[model samples]
Each structure stands twice: as structure tokens, then as C-alpha cells.
Target: MNDYVRGSAWRVPVTACQPRPLSAFLSRNAQRRPASAIRSLLPLEQEPGMISLLAGKPNPATFPIEEIAVKVRLPDDASSPVVVAVTGDRLQKALQYGPTAGTPALVDWLAQLTSSLHGRPLPAQSSDSTKPWQLAVGNGSQDLIVKAFEVILDSGDTALLQSPTYPGVLPALCVGQVNTVAVESDEAGIRADALERMLARWDVDEKTSSLARPKLLYMVPTASNPTGTSTSLDRKRALLRLARKYDFLLFEDDPYYHLSFEEATPSLFALDGQDSDHDQGRVLRFESLSKVMSAGLRIGFVAGPSVLVDAINKYTATSHLQVSGVSQCVAIAVLEQMGHRGFLQHAARTADFYRRRRDAFERIAHEILRAEPPVAEWTSPGGGMFLWLRLLLPLNANTAEGDSFALISTQARRAGVLAVPGVAFLASSGGTSTYVRVSFSLIGEEDTAEAFRRLRRVILDL
Candidate 1:
């Protein structure tokens, strides 16, 4: 009876549950793994009056660089620039090998930052009680995404993913031999009806009968890649209810959370933490500095239940050892210079920059693609860099259904325009699609009209 409460947000009973022990879900390889001897000793060095003779880290004094300075362009002018510097102790940390989890200062700063942003309680150091959550730094969110899969999946384990999802995740899923089930989506992102139906019939369905019931649901919720759609607050609550019903973990990969052109919706992580009785166990959220700050820095942080984070850290210990110390140090210096308020202000400016690009790109698309006897249709994105276009093309011999592959790879390329064919984002291979993904992120302002013009010509010819 403790597991059910009536008349909550779902119009269904809220399920009171605890996360399954992480050890029960870890892969065989992860279960057999050992901690890095050097990494284990890193904590002893922190004790007062203690000196480390252990790690083979090269002396920072041997490094040649004395200081590093970064020039940040002003959002409005670009004529005036501000300089942020890394020197003294910070510079020393940059040049040396650091802790596998991350540098202490950056880790603590991100912990507080995430807590404030997501409305969650800060994780405490003591382990006597059930610690609600923790954070881990990775080379990038992409790196963390792969590791998360490794931690949870065996060779044939199943995972539920949104349709037309981020293409980057496909290869990682393949590498882990994880089976992916696609959940349908609409303009507001993943549809709860489709997801609920899939889960309800999973065990009895012939297609999924042999496959293990999925324990994880991977989603990009805000400004989903390729689709350019965001999940609404009502939809998020519905999805979380399904997650509770199915007892599955939700991986919220939200790199574009801060890049919304309109007001942002509450994230699944934030929503899950809203319950006063539960801190968080069902949602693991990822954040990145790539889009907001610098992609080249390759700094990202993951926040979730401590049990899951501990497994990810164990994998990190043996794998990359740690993210590049120089990268983390550079990130920390820039973040400190910006401070919390300034960082948010910078995010708003970045969003405005993309909003301009989206406006110009959409105007051209409407003029060219939405003419008499329209050649294509698309959703105007509220945020992020992509425009997902469903092309109106004739059916070919290769596919009974209209597909964009030849039009994009062959015809569009010859016409001097590039776009990713939609089939690449599907859960399974060799499917036909009339959709294509066009990006406005790095495309030039002057070339927007011409690019769409060329694409229109190609479609008209087809």
C-alpha cells in the first residue's frame, strides 16, 4: 500500500519505490572491474600535513607555460573583448594529472550549479545515510552517455528511445550490443500514449517477447536533436508517471536546456525532485559547456543518484583515467570569471544569436518550400539549431514510401547544399524516410537563402 497514492498528477496512483541496487544492474565486465590503484590513493593526499609520493604525475614546475589567457568576444559588439586568465595554482592544476572524477573545486561548483538549476538537494559527503545524489565530470556529455550505457546494459538488454532521436547515440548503442525500441513523437516531443501502449503490451507482443523489458528510457526532452521539438510540462509529468509505473530510469540528455529561445519548461530531473519525500532516483541529467561556452574545451558534468554515479566513476577510473586536466582547469577559470548571474546572461545572449539565425532560416524555408503545391513542411523550432523537414517527394522503386536519402546524398549534394537524411536517426537501419535534418548552427548568415534556394531547386527537379 506504501507503493501507491491516489489522485496525483497522473490521475493515477503515485508509486513509492526505491531504485534497484546498482550492483544488480551492472554488466559482467563492470562487476569484475577493479579501482585504479593510483586513483584510490588520491584522497589521502588531501589530509592535513600529508604528502604524496605515490602517483606518477609529473611536477607542475617542469611545465613551460607560465600563464594562459582567453579572449571572449562581447555578444553585442564583438569589437570589445574581455580577457579571463588562468595562472598560479589554477594553471598548475591545468598542466598536471588530476583526480579521475574531476578537480575538487570544479566538481563542487558544478554540484551547486546543478542543484540550483534543477531544484534538488545538494549531495553530502558522509555515506552513513542514503545520499540523494552526486556529480561526475567527463570529457563531454557524449562520453558520459556511452559510459551510462555501459553501466546499465548487457549485450542484449533493451532500451526505449524516442523516434528520430540524436544520431550520435546510435553507434554507442551498437557498440554495447543494446537493443533499442523506438517511441513515437510529435511536435511537442515523445507521445505518452505511444509509450504507455508499448510498455503495457511489451511482454505479450511477439516482437518484444524475446527481448528483456527495457530498464532505461533515453530522451533529449528539450529541443530534441534532429526534431527541434521540446517536451511540454504536461507531457513530462505524464512520461514521469509512466517511468514510475514501469520502474524504468530516465536519462535526460539536456545539452540544449540553456539554449531555449522561449521560456524553458521544467526538466524531468527537476520534476522528479519536486516530490518532498523523494530526492531523485529515476532521472539522471547531463549538462555541457560545449554549446554555451566552448565546444573545444570538452567539459561536461553528470548528476544523478550516488549509486549510479559511483559505477560511472569506477568505469572512468580504468578507462580514460580522467578527463583532460587542462580542459577542466580552463573551464573552471572561465566559469569563475562569468560567475552564476553572468553565466546565465551569456546563455541568454547565445540563445538570441541562434534565434536570429532560426528566424532568417525559417523565412527562407517558408518562401521556397511552402509555395504553391508545397515541396516540404516543418515545425518552427522553439530552440536549438536544427530544422526537421518532411519532404514531399514522389515514391521511387527503391522504396514504396518516399525517402530523402538519394535526394540529400546525391541530388542535394550536387546542388551545393548539405543535409542529413532522416533515416540515420531511426532506431533500425534501411528504412525509408521523407524527412531531412537541416542545421543553422554553423551555416553563414549570407548563405541561408541561397542554401534553401538550392535545396528547393533540387526538390523541384525530383
Candidate 2:
């Protein structure tokens, strides 16, 4: 495909910035991958007055299931749950096989949502044609992320991500024989200045010179997984500048974009257009419906350059085939009823729900852990489900900063409190950290106090 694949226009930011060619980044596997023969023709079956024969698609009539109904409560109201149902042609679409990209109805809705939210043009709406950008739905964001890693990075290639990164992406790296490199992160996520210093001296840096230049820089960006640190607009602009200058795609794994304590946080995907010189497709964003809707539904979508999105869809064709048809149908129906505005309203409610939990968690921690000189320190999350606590445990000579592994694992477990060891999130660190990640999403308001009380007792004993 050409670097600047011109696309037919749509109603959204129909003429966004031209994207840079991904030729430099695509793995050898992606370059040689041919289109799936059967899945390639799946779209033709949808055209008017066509499709008598296709693959061994089972008859929906034979399936005993008749309907899929979902009950959902309103964002503001707690009184009643509204029942959303899928039937007729929609039901048929749900029962049978689906297009490789996604159920058309769901994909269209997501495309529209992405375009409107991101201020980017609608990608040319077809599989056969090419465009600078496109969208593909997946089983979940993690599913699409794995495929992206497979398609983009080959053996011995390097993947750069923030220290204390999401553990989910680590396992995926094994497939590509990739080298994991961690850049330090502060309270606002990955430090752009630190990255700038490293990249400026890439060849001279003995530790990095042997490895290939990083083709992708992955980040959670908003309410980061273990740190709960969110980058501001200025911070994001600085990072985008770095991505532009460094010539690496920004792989934004932003499941919590809609779950912010404040207004909807614009993703790197949404902000790329604001930088005039920044290439539009340099930011490939993976978004999940799991945080806002249902995790078991296993629904997520990727929105970015068409070449990359297509690469992932091709992988999906051979793997899971497509996201659950019923899940897509159910999502489409619920979203159709809610509309775009209603969806945001629901997201606001979800954010507020977590925010309350965070507040209660913070208050309890302050009372128990901060009673004396303070047993631990943490930044209260702006959004998302976590509280990252930096415990002030007794320090050893080897770990001047202190280590939470033993304290959080053995000691804390014995004290009846559990949190993810900070080392689990680091790629290179030798399991040394004074940090532990706790979730404020599930615990009740009443239980917050005792949870910290247990931790305080553990700290005092040690």
C-alpha cells in the first residue's frame, strides 16, 4: 500500500493530516501476509442481490437461541433497568458468522464515534480499498494489541514502554522475540525529557546501540495501570513531538479514557491532529468497552492507520475469526438506544462511581497510614480504578528506595491485605520497589478503613 493512501471522504474531519508510511515499522511477517481467501470475500455477501453460496456458515434457524436481551440502568437513575433487545436481521447477524473487521453495525458506530471524538476523518469504509486510517473491532483491546505487536515487531526488535507498564502487553512480546526497554515514569507518566535525552544519544549509548531502534512506544497515558498517573495536554503534546521527531508510532492502550474523574480525556489518537506537523496515523489507539460496559463481552476496537488496522484484522481472520457476533449486536443495540450523548452520560456515572471509591480509599489511608509520620505515600488517581501506594518500609542497602515485594507478598498477605507487587509492572527492574498497586473499584466504602489498617499493622511489625 502507498504511504499516503488517499481515501474517499466522509462527514467527519474528512481531510485530516496525511499519515506517514509504516513501511519502516511493519515486521517481515506482516509484509508477506496475504489476504484471507474466505474472509476476504465476506463483505461481498452483504451487497444487494448477491451471495447464494459462501463458506460453511451454519443456518441461524438451526440455532436454538431466539433473542439476546440486555438490561441496563440509566446513568443518573437507579430506579429501573431498561431492557435492550436484538432481533430480526440484527439477531441473524448475531447468530451467524461476522465480517473479519467486526459486525458492520458495530464497526460503523465505532468508526463514527472515533471520528467525532478524535477530530479525524472517517477512513475509507471498505476492506478491499486502502486509506491512511481505519478502524477494526476486536475481542478486546488486548487481543488487537497482541496482533499489532506481532505485525509490527520481528525477532530481536525493541519495544519501548513506560516503566511499571501494564503487565498484559509483556506476554505478547514473547511472540515477536522482542527486546523490552523501559523508560522511567514520573507522576505524569513517561517523562518526555528523559526519553528525549536517551533518543538523542541512541547510537552512543552502549546499553541501547546493539538493539534496533524502537519502532513503537506503548503507554496507558491516562490513569496509568500501576501508577494512576495521567499526562496533561501539554505533556501529551511534548510526547507527540518526541514521537514525531523520533519517528516511532505511539501505541496508546487507553481503556480508561472514558473513565476519567474529569471530562472525557482526549486520547493520543484524538490529539495527533492538533499538531500540524505530526503525522495523523503515528498514533495507533486501542480502546476497550470492557471498562465502560462489560468485560466478559470481550469487545474492543482499534482506530488508526488502515495498514495497521488491516494487519490486525488479517490476523483475526486466522485466529478468532471475529469478535463475538452476539456481543457486537448487543453493544450496537444498547448504544443505538443511548446515542453518543447518552454513552458519555453513562461514562460519567461510571467515573463518578470509581471516584467515590477512590475518595473513600484515600480518606481511610490518610487516617490510618498517615496518623504518625506517614507509613506510605501515593498520588490520588484522577480517574480509573487504582491507587498506587509507595510504602515507607524499612530500607536495605541494596534497595535505598525500599522494596514492596516481600512486604506486599508475604507480610501483607499474612496480614490479610493483598496488592500487586510493583515489580510485576517493571520490565528490567530486579523486583525492587516500595510501590504496590491497589484497586479502589471493587472495595465497599465500609471496608476501605480496615484494608489500610491491615497494611499499617504489617508496616509496624516489620
- Among the numbered candidates, top lDDT falls to 1
Q: Residues 245-352, candidate 2, lDDT per residue (tens digit)?
A: 666788999999888886555678888866665466688899999999889989999988777887888888877788888888888898888888888888888888
For candidate 2, the TM-score is 0.92
TM-score of 1: 0.93
Clashes of each: 0, 0
- What residue pairs clash in candidate 1, if any at all? none
Each prediction's TM-score against the native?
0.93, 0.92
lDDT of each: 0.82, 0.80
lDDT at residue 271 of model 2 (Cα atoms):
83
Residues 1-462, candidate 1, lDDT per residue (tens digit)? Answer: 333211111111223245444455566666777878788788898899998788887877789999889886645445878887888987887788788789888998898888888888888778713678889999899999889888877777788899988888899888887888898999988998888887777767898766776768899998899888898899898988888766678999999988888788888988988876643578889889999998998998898878788888889998888999888887887777667777888899899999998998888889878887788999998889999999999877877768998889999999998899999999867687999999999887568878888888898897
